[model samples]
Target: MARSLKNPKKRKNKGSKKGGGASSSSIPSLPTKVWQPGVDKLEEGEELQCDPSAYNSLHAFHIGWPCLSFDILHDQLGLIRTGFPQTVYCIAGTQAEKAPWNYIGVFKLSKISGKRRDLVPKRHDDDGDGDDDMDSESSSDDEEEGGEGESQPPVLQLHKVAHEGGVNRIRAMAQNPHICASWADTGRVQIWDLSADLNALAESEADVSTGGSTLLSRAPLIKFGGHKDEGYALDWSPLVSGRLLSGDCKNCIYLWEPSSSATWNVDPSPFIGHTASVEDLQWSPTEPDVFASCSVDWTIAIWDARRGKSPAAVIKAHKADVNVISWNRLASCMIASGSDDGTFSIHDLRQLQGDSRVAHFEYHKLPITSIEWSPHEPSTLAVSSADNQLTIWDLSLEKDEEEEAEFKAQIKEKVDVPEDLPPQLLFVHQGQKDLKELHWHGQIPGMLMSTAADGFNILMPSNIENTLPSENS
Candidate 1:
C-alpha cells in the first residue's frame, strides 16, 4: 500500500533521512571562497585588483543556476563578524548538479570599527564624538551626500555549511543571529543553532573545512521534511519569534507554526495565488502578518498571513517573470519589484489597482536581477542587472525642504500622492561583472554592498559620511 510522504511529522522515516548512514551519505560537498584547485572558477576576465572596499566572492562558488531557481533578494546576503562573529550567507536553489552535491558559500568579515579611519572620507562631526563610525542618522541633511571616500576593504573570509541538494532558501532569525532556518531542495525544512559568542557561534578553526579561518555549522540542529518539490523562498517573521513562511516551485506557500521547541508543524493547506513558482517572499516591516510575494507569473501579490485562502491585493506586476521584490523600510506604502525584462517598478500598496505603478525604471538594457531601497533614505535606491551594471537612484525631483515635508506628510496623513516624477540617477559603480545583487548597509548611511557572478563588493560614496539622525531614529 502506498501512502503520502508529504508531511513527515507523523510518519516514521518518512520525508527525511533523519540520522545514520543515509543522512551522512547525503551531506553535500560544500564550497567556500578560498578558490580551490578544481572547486572554484574565476569569472572570465576577472583579475585581482587591490580594491580597498571590495571583498572576495562569497557567493555560491560552484553551484550554477537551477532550472526553477529561487533568486536571492529579500532573504538578505553577506556575512559580518561582530564580537559574536555574525554574518549572512544565502542558499542557492534546486537539486545538485554534476559537481557532485549542492553547495552553499558564506563570506565572513571581521567587525573592525575604527580600522578604516584613514580610508573613509572625512565627515563633519556635529556631536563631537571625535570619530565617525559610519552609523550616522538619516535625515534631510544627508540626502545630498555621496560616496567620496576610499572603500574600507573588509577583512573577508569564507566558511561552509553542508546539506543535501543545495539550500533552496535561508532565513536568519531576526531576534537571534545564532538561529537560522533553511529550506532544502530534498524536501526538508531545517533549523540551525549557531553559537552565541564569537568563539561559540561556530565550530573551532580545525573544522574550518573550506580553509582559511572558518566558523560554520557542520550539520543542522534538527531538520524535517514537509513540502513536496524543490523549495524556493522562506521568510522569518519580523514580529513573531518562531513563525516562518516557505514557498515552493508548485506555487504552494506553507505556514510553519512552532509546535514545540524543536519541531514545527506545517499547516496542511498552502497559500495559493501565483500560477507559477513563487520566486521571493518578504515579511512586511510595519504589519506583523502582512507579507508580499513575486512570482514567475508576472505578478506581485500582498497577503495577510491569517487569510490564507486568497491574496489581499494583487498587482499585474511585470511584463516578464517578476525576479524579485522588496518593501521599503521607511515608507510603509512604497514597494519595489524587478523583472526578467530589464525593468523595475515602484508601487504604493495603498493603490494596488491595475495602473498603480508609482514609478517605472528601464535604465538597464539587461534584465534587472536585484533592487534595494535604502533603509536609511526613503527616496534612495540601488539596482543591479544581468549586464554587470550597478546604479544608485535618487527617487526625488523636488527640492530638499519641500521633499522632506512632502514625505513626512505622506507618511503621517494619507494625503493624495503627487504625480510620479522620474528620479535622478545618483551614481554608477564600475569594475564588476555578472552583477546579480545589491543592498544598503543598515549601519552605514550610504554604504552599499553588491554581489555578482564574479564576486562581492562593498561600495562607498564620496559623501556617505554626512548625516544627522532622524528624530524617531
Candidate 2:
C-alpha cells in the first residue's frame, strides 16, 4: 500500500516526442532572506540551552508489540490525555515462553506542578475577588504554619475487563458509540460498560482482577458466539447500536444483535459469507448494509447484511492471499485492500458492476500488511508493508487537465538540479523488519501508529508538526 509518488515529479516534454527540459530563463531565483527564528542567530559551534523546566512530564510506553488495541479517546485530542484518567487494554500474541497473553493495566498521569516545585515559583493571593473574611483567616493560618505544601498532577488508571482464556491473538476490539467496549475472542464476543469505570481505578490501589473474579463482579453485558474457529476481527455496526459483526478464521462472518433476555443472549445467524480464512473485515461507514472482508483465499468479497447465501460481489483481486481490506468512509463505492503479493487495489463497487476492472494499484515491493484511510480526509490512505515502511496516497489528485499542467510544471522545476530529490520514503521502523499491524488513531486523522518486530512507532502526516524534536535541540 505504499504511495506511488516515491520520487519527485519529473518534467514532461512539450514539442519533442519525449518530454523536454525547461528553458534556463524559466527557472525561478532563490529567495535572498529565508526566515529562521529564535536560536537561528547562534553559530553552528555555539551551545544553545533549553529551559528544562518547560519540558512535558507525560510519557507513553507500549507493553509489547501491540497486536489489537484501540485508543479510548476520539481523534479530536492527541495521545490519550497524558496521564489523564484512562485505561489501556490489549491482547498480545503468544511469545516463546507464554501461552496466549492478555494484559489490562491502569496508568495515571502525574501532575507536573508538584514534581517541579523547585523549578517553579509560587505566589500568594493578596488581591482576592471575594472571601475577604476567609482571606484574613488564611493569612493567620499561613503565619502560624509558615511552610509550603506541594500538589501532584493527575494520573490515569487502568483496569482489566476480565475474560476466560485471556484474549486470543486474532480478535478485534471496538468501542461502540453508545459507550460500550466490545471484544471478540476465541468463540465469543463480550461487551463491557466502560462508562462506570472511567476514573474509578484512579481512586483504588488494589490490583485489578481477571477471569471468574471479574465475571462475578462485572459480568459481560452481552455475549455472542457461533463461530467454530478463532474470531479474527469484529466491528460494531455503525448504523446499529446493539448490533455487531464478527469474522472468524474459518471463513465465516456473523452478525449479532443483543437480546432483551436476562442473559443478553445474541442471535448468531444474521449474516455470513467468505470462502477461506477471513483475515480482516470492515463495516462500511457510509452504507451500513454493505461490508467487506478479505481472506487467505486471494479474494475480496462484499456482503449485504440483509441477504444470507452468497456475497453481494466477489472480486478475485490479488495474485496472492488478501490480508486486509478497508472501505472508504466518505465514498460508499470505493474500497481498498492489501495482499501477500506486495500490492494494493482501489476498487469502485459501482464500476465493478460492468465489464471494466476498476482502478487498482501495485506499489509495495513486499507483502502489503495493512491499509487504513484518513479518518478526516477520505481521499487519503495510509498503507504499511513488510518492508518496514508506511506510505500515504492522495487519491483526490486529478488525472486530467490540472494533472497535465502540474506535470509540465514539475519538469520545468527540476531542470536546474543535477540530481533530483529522492522519493518520500519514510522508514517507519528503520531497520528492515516486518510491520505486523498498522492503525490510524481514532482521534488523529492523519496520525497512524504501527507495530513491528522491532518496536512500536507513531507516524503523523508529513505535513503536520514533527513533535519529536531532535535530541540536540
Identify the candidate with maximal lDDT: 1
lDDT of 1 by residue, 272-332 (tens): 9989888778889889889899888999989997776689988998889887788887887
lDDT digits (tens) for residues 56-155 of candidate 2: 1212233332333333233222442222122233223311112233433222222222111112123347755332332133332222111233222223
Question: What value of lDDT does candidate 2 attain over all alpha carbons?
Answer: 0.48
- Candidate 2: list runs displaced more than 4 Å: 1-60, 64-72, 75-97, 104-157, 166-185, 201-218, 260-265, 270-272, 355-358, 397-433, 453-455, 464-473
TM-score of each: 0.64, 0.59
Worst 10 residues of 1 by lDDT: 16-25
Model 1 stretches with alpha carbons more than 4 Å out: 1-107, 111-153, 196-217, 222-224, 398-423, 463-465, 469-473
- Each model's lDDT: 0.55, 0.48
Relative to the true structure, candidate 1 reaches a TM of 0.64
In Å, residue 251's CA in model 2 sits off its true spot by: 1.5
